[model samples]
Target chain A: MNTLDARGYSCPEPVIMTKKALEKGLPLTVMVDGVTPLNNITRFAQNKGYKVESRAVGEDYELTISK
Target chain B: MKNKQTLLIAATGLVVGALAVLLTLNGNPANMGFCIACFLRDTAGALGLHKAAVVQYARPEIIGLVLGAFIMSVAGKEFAAKGGSSPMTRFVLGFFVMVGALMFLGCPLRMVLRIAGGDLNAVVGLIGFVCGILGGIFFLKNGFTLKRTYTLSRLEGTWMPILSLGVLALLLLAPSLLAFSESGPGSMHAPVMMAQAAGLIVGALAYKTRLCMVGGIRDAVLFGDFYLLYGFVAIIIAALIGNLAIGSFNLGFDGQPVAFNDGLWNFLGMALTGLGSALLGGCPLRQLILAGSGNSDSAVTVMGMIVGSAFCHNFGLASSADGPTSAGKIAVIIGFAVVIVIGLANMRKEKV
Candidate 1:
């Protein structure tokens, strides 16, 4: 399992970063703000067959992916 | 695999569109609802690019769509900076697309919104668009070719994003340059930052997903690809939900905002745009994204849209809420003929 942080990033940035990390072909964790980035990242993850879970942590969202 | 991709693309478009509609409900405007064409038209006016006083404003959706595309491209490692195709031809096609869009006073996206809003006129315009697209498909099948492009330096394709950033700077630092309507359709707007932010994000996402209405239809019709088309459907559904949420659902054609009562011209105008987009290989939104990715051809098309707006307004070829100008009707006819001639003429004598 691998973890990537994107908490302070804006929409698409977090998603894009998460995607970049996923290119390593390992289960990963992504953090993002707002509903949009979450949707984008989660969809990307789900499509790739990575198991995913999300929870609101204070001001932002934390999403963890596993395969 | 294709179904999943289709669902993702369409769902993303729907979510983005719904968010855009939410912006409108919070004081944006009606049936304007969510349109890249109308918004770009307003942005042009805000820059005093045209004197159509009733329809100018700095549209956030346009800004958001591009920036959104940029962000995704950069993040996903897919933002390959590249450009150079038949720039002048692309520009002319873009201009004609805008001309046609103004005739209808809406692009493909708006056509969808119109249908969602229950405007029967849009149904006619959509049929025209399909006919035009079919025509373009014919050209495509017959080896009508725009030359293959060579990838350009990254900085070359970064011009649109830089320009967008400049617009944002102007919006925030020099507000006076943006024309605001004292009354009428131009006066209505969501907040400047909000509009820009939304546009930027949507643009970036669209760039990454390659969510193009023109490509969606073309691919579906020509190649049997449905990924992009799904995004097109998503936008309508999201817009409907957003309209419902904001109590802006009108459900009929009697009185749509920023749209005219002319039906035939609307059909012709959208038909022109549809054909132009098909020939050019992307919608206006796709053009912007391509420009962001360093495609000079797309940049040229965008330039055409800017110039076409000027021509549409100056020559009285643009429609108003009341209806299409007589000049606009003539322009639509001439515009269509001109595009047909150019498209056929541009075909290479030898297959590339």
Candidate 2:
């Protein structure tokens, strides 16, 4: 599993970057802050039907997706 | 000229726009509300031109609007192929307009409808739009002009309708490539045929009436004309009723579906849209109508809108379900500067 630290990115950057990461065909973990990013990234992964697990960690979030 | 004719057009536009929204609720897209700007943005997303990932679809209403308007133009013999008025500038304006609308999370039509639906942030947006359009009017009064267009061969203009047809064909044949959202904003859509029919009806009426919010406001302010602006009011009344009937009126900005409540950005974003639409000579819907009539300038504007959506999504300038991004704010600032420069540099001085 590859982990993406998207803590600093906003809006579509995290979504776009995650899309780029997915092009490499790997299970992934994306760390984000706030519910909007979580919703965007979660929707992105779920739209592609990637298995995802999300949990809150401090002020940030950890989202794990499996290929 | 005639009250009956005006009333007919306004009523038809209202019904068609409302039906478009209701259809969106059934299966098309949520809160779409007959916006060429937003539909073109979504079309850009469906093509993977930009990976917003949340809002992507080859909206049938967009296709329907162009095709519908084309049919009306042909039937009425009002179709004339013309263009070449600072095409590149118009394209950029269209693009920036989309970026601004996305930042506010809706187009001009949707902006008004959102307000009618009780989203108070739209009040800020509407104010911004009016102010922006008034700014464009100032440029106009000072002799800001895009180059005039001459007639083009009819065959050349037919290509836009053909392109729309091709899109419709792709939508029906390879639906998967359209890339609808399964669980987000894109997941919400009006029914396809219903949406298309609504668009077709609205396009036809708008083609006849020259229905455009920016044009309406600009004309009212600049020329003391209120005919076109009345249609805008009609749409608000109709959409408000529809929202009430559907139980979607929320009366606040905080939790409105498909909208964000960042007051400053909301105001500025729509102001940018209003200004751009004014400079381009029409709102997004009017641009589509112009394109259908073979105005390549409008076509270029439409293309620019699609590209702008791609740029906004890819560059983090678009607002999301959460709110507007910082990049979106910066882009709006830059976009405003760009519009100001375009207006100033392109102003034509009267020859002695």
Candidate 3:
């Protein structure tokens, strides 16, 4: 499992990072600090046909995306 | 619960729209209240950053907006000092956004208001704006990004708010220090305190609701999310009702107050604005709110806008009611070129 810390990034940035990380193969864990990024990454990952599981990790969100 | 939240967002839009109309009725230019680009240009003129005599004023609404967002963010525990995410790039994007906005004589927010006031020229602008956003969405799907931001000291985040307060102080205590328009759009204004109050109220609501016209349309195209778009639609409806009630609705393209009937320039101008704002991750109003909440990158963006406003007037690149100047048209073309280059340059190389 590869974890990408996207905790402080804003929109489109997080989604882009997720796209880049997904290129290296999954299951991938993405961490974000806000709802906007969480929702954005979830949307991006789901749109790409990946299964995404998201949960709160102490005021931040962790999303696990897998094929 | 989601329905309630959506309704509250709509209510916020209504209040904002009604305030805009009230501001217009109370002395602000007809159909010309709360234009972020115009206000920044006026503020630039007031500061002597540009010699545009007819548009000089230290607009209190701008100050109120920043301070309102600052107070709300602090109270909500949402304020965080952050920056260092390609500040110069954001600055350039901000500058071009202002360029496009001045060319069109409004921002996306004002574009909506113009449509509500029955300016068909704005309808043409809207079509251009949506086209630009769709273009941005293409880049977004291809992994366009401006990189990530870093956390900074609290003092770094407070600079914009402090600057806002300093401007407010100057506007109140030392009015003689800044230039005031003798006549024209700058000379016409709502009472300072009333306009400030209106800005404060709208700023607070907008910050809370994350009301951003660029984000509204971008999200709609990117994620099928209409959450943000609903706010803008509500604004149009509310402002439409207010305009009709006040007999301010002219319902035509020609002779609309403070707007030109030139459809092509209006479209291209807003197209540039939409593309720039989409690349910057927010619109001018959103940049202001983000700056208030301690985003130094956004503060730099706002500064870029001020400078851009000055540049537009100083170099004769801004349009007037007579319509877009030749220089302004060329600048808009250059703006599109620069923004497109930026969009292409920022795409992840691997993805491209």
Best by lDDT: 3
Local accuracy of candidate 3 as per-residue lDDT tens digits, B39-73: 98999999899998999998888888888889998
* DockQ sort, best first: 3, 1, 2
Given the true complex, what DockQ would model 1 score?
0.02
Best by DockQ: 3
Candidate 1 fnat reads: 0.00
The whole-model C-alpha lDDT of candidate 1 against the native structure comes to: 0.74
Q: What tens-digit string does per-residue lDDT give for candidate 2 at B1-352?
A: 2466468657865775577558755865445566666788778877788777777888888888898889988897657677666889998899889989889988888887777778898999999999999998788766676755655688767777888888898889988776665666665677778778887888888877777888778766764546577888888888788878887777976878787888898999999999999888788988887788777778888888989988988999989769999999999999999999998988768510
Which CAPRI quality tier does the interface of model 3 achieve? Answer: acceptable
Q: What CAPRI grade goes to candidate 1?
A: incorrect
Ranking by lDDT: 3, 2, 1
TM-score of chain B of each: 0.94, 0.96, 0.98
Chain A vs. true chain A, TM-score per model, equals: 0.78, 0.89, 0.96
Model 2 docking category: incorrect
What are the DockQ scores of the candidates, in order?
0.02, 0.01, 0.37
Give per-residue CA lDDT, model 1, range B1-352, as digits (tens).
4466566687678867776676666567666655767777777888888887887777766766666777776776556554455778888898899999988978887787777666778888888898888888777665465555555688877787788778778777888868877777678877766666667767766775777778777766764545577888888888777677767777666687677667788778889999998888878878877676556677778888988987888789888778888898888788889888877886757432
Give the poorly placed runs of model 1, Cα more than 4 Å off: A1-67, B1-3, B348-352
Interface C-alpha root-mean-square deviation of candidate 3: 3.6
